[model samples]
Target: MRIAVAAPTGHVGRHLVPMLIRAGVKPLLLLRDPDRLAPDVRPEVDVAEVDLLDADAVVRAVSGVDALYWVDPPPAGHNPLAEYKLATASAARAVTEGGVGRVVFQSSVGAERRHGMGEIDGLAATEVALNATDANVVHLRCGYFFTNLEYQVDAIRAGALQVLLPVNQPMAWVSPRDIAEVAAGRLLSEEWRGRIVQAVHGPADLSWQQVVGIISEAVGKPLEVERIPEEEMRGTLAGFGMSAEQIDSLVGMSTGFLGGFTPEQERSVHSTTPTTLAEWAYTELKPMLQ
Candidate 1:
């Protein structure tokens, strides 16, 4: 099977290419600059350069593919929603026109709106776009990334871990690798179609403080998790290059996290390998903390 993957250098892409190769699927990556791919990932995957915004280019590039790993780039400047909408729209059009067979969209877990809670409008919009295509679309609603703790790795090393989360919502954190595994299954299998897959944390849900404690223990330090005012999160994020609108959107998203999510139905979907926060801290995130 021929698979086309966009933004194959991003977090999920790092694991996806290898899985695709091992599954005996020919992987073609759509990247702005092919050099961005890791050396090991690049050699095994075919490269194609096509601006996703350009219809003709997308149609040409999307043709004759069995599946697509759609990871639309966050828009340039400040409009993440606009970028998400436009990019997904283009991909949907191109896929329909090109007669692509399957699509595995990398979407956030709570991409739906809840009253006084978190909203996932962007993911919902992407789902609508992908649904319009003739191809079987599997929306992988990925859980909160464990890598979000990367920012705090430095703080953990410094012996003062300041966790900025506002509430103690139980969230199932999943690694990009696990997300890729689920996505690869959907991409490679024609049996499952037109379904939404919520890929969540391996073991179970963990609260913000629990995660902080786990990290502190992993680093062997008595770190402090200082909670900051919710009003300041947007401005604080701006320093990290997030646009004003993105800051707002993310803040709104966090509200959902504080409200909480359920792993009820998704727990039966399979792909649970059972890795915990402490395990990730001791392994993947340990060195970074040091």
Candidate 2:
């Protein structure tokens, strides 16, 4: 079967494309710049460079695909919902025009809850838009990325670990590679279409303090977890060029953690991904710390 992947050069895509190929499914990778295509994808996969916002370009890239893997980047100017809206609309048009039958959207966990953040709202918009299509749409609401620790990797390397915010709060963190695996499964399996499959997290949950300890062991170094103050978080986020809305959204996310935003118990029933914090730390993060 033919699958069209948007942003095939992204973190998830880098892992996802190989899995799809191994399963005997052909992936049509769509990117804005072909030069960014990874070596593995460039030579073997069918690729198209087109402006994602351009309706004609989207249609051309998506045409003749049986399935789609949608990944929309954060919108410009901190309006998280705007870019997703644009991408979703463009994809919606392409799905109709190109005869694509199924779509696997990469969304965040708790999207259905509409919790305190612009991310929830933006994901909700995309979900609503995709629901309009006749094609089977599956919204894969992923959990908080364990890879978020990459930001703290430097601190771990330096033997001074700074747990950003929500230091004591436990989060259900899932690996991006595991998320990609689940997405690949749904994209290939016909029975999963038209379903809202939420890959909530792995076996257990961990607080930021535990995360630092795991990294310390994996990297073979002793480190201390120094929690960052809430007041400084806004400025730190601003340094990353986040919009006011985006900054507020992230700040609000920490509030949920503090206020007890636990994962629903039913997540294991529909979606089961088995990758723990230590496993992720040992595999993906250990080398980065070195």
Candidate 3:
């Protein structure tokens, strides 16, 4: 089967591409810069250089593909909700025009609700728009990314872990590799039909304190947990040069998480992946720290 993948250079896409190849499926990568693809993988698959925001370009790129793996990358200094809507609309148009048979979208948890969801609203909008297309769609409602902690490596190394949410609130966290595995399996199989919503949660629902404890144990250092207030999140993001819209969106997401807006279902036996916090820390997180 031939599958077209958007954001092929992203965190999940980078892992998914190799898995697709191993499963005896061909991947047509839609890349902004084809050179960003690993040199070894380039000769194995087809490449299409196209801007996702351009409906005509996306339509051309997805033409003749059997399936599509759609992942919207983080927005670049614009209204994230509006940007996602445009991208989803473009992809939906392409799927209809190109006659793509199936689509597996990378969406987040709590996308079932329509409002007060900050960045998640974008995924919710994407889900609604893609559902309107003719092709079969599967929404992988993923949880918080464990890799997001990598951004705080410096602070972590200094024995401090900061978060906007309460330290004791439990939230599901998934590894990108696990997400890739599930997505690859879905892309390779023809079992699922129509609209499917699969909650891709991690092995455990852990609190911020629990996660920090794991990290501290892995790093062999006592770590301090600092919970920043919701109001301070805007100023913190703004200090990083994020625009007003971006700040509002990010803060909104944090607020939603603090309000217990994550996936409510138990982890499915079929969806439980092999990777764990300790494994990820020993492998991915530790290497980055050094």
Measured against the true structure, the TM-scores of the candidates, in listed sequence, are 0.87, 0.87, 0.96
- Name the regions of candidate 2 deviating beyond 4 angstroms: 76-78, 160-165, 226-229, 239-243
In candidate 3, stretches whose alpha carbon ends up further than 4 angstroms from where it belongs are: 262-264
| TM-score pick, better of 2 and 3 | 3
Clashing pairs in 3: none
Question: Candidate 1 at 79: error in angstroms?
Answer: 1.6
For residues 1-290, could you state the per-residue lDDT of candidate 3 as single tens digits? Answer: 78999998888999999998888777899988999999999988899999888889999989889989998768875688778777878778888998899999999887887667788888888888889988899999888888898888888989987788888988778899899999988998999899988888878878889998998888778888989877676777778888887877887776876555646455788656768888888888877777
Clashing pairs in 2: none
lDDT tens per residue, model 1, 116-152: 2323566667777787767787777666777777866
Q: On residues 186-276, what C-alpha lDDT tens digit does candidate 2 reach at each position?
A: 7898875565656557656677778778877887888777777766878888998877877876676555445666555455656657888
Q: Which candidate do you rate higher for lDDT, 1 or 2? A: 2
**Pairs of residues at least 3 apart in sequence or in different chains that clash in candidate 1:** 111-120, 118-256
What lDDT does each candidate get?
0.72, 0.75, 0.85
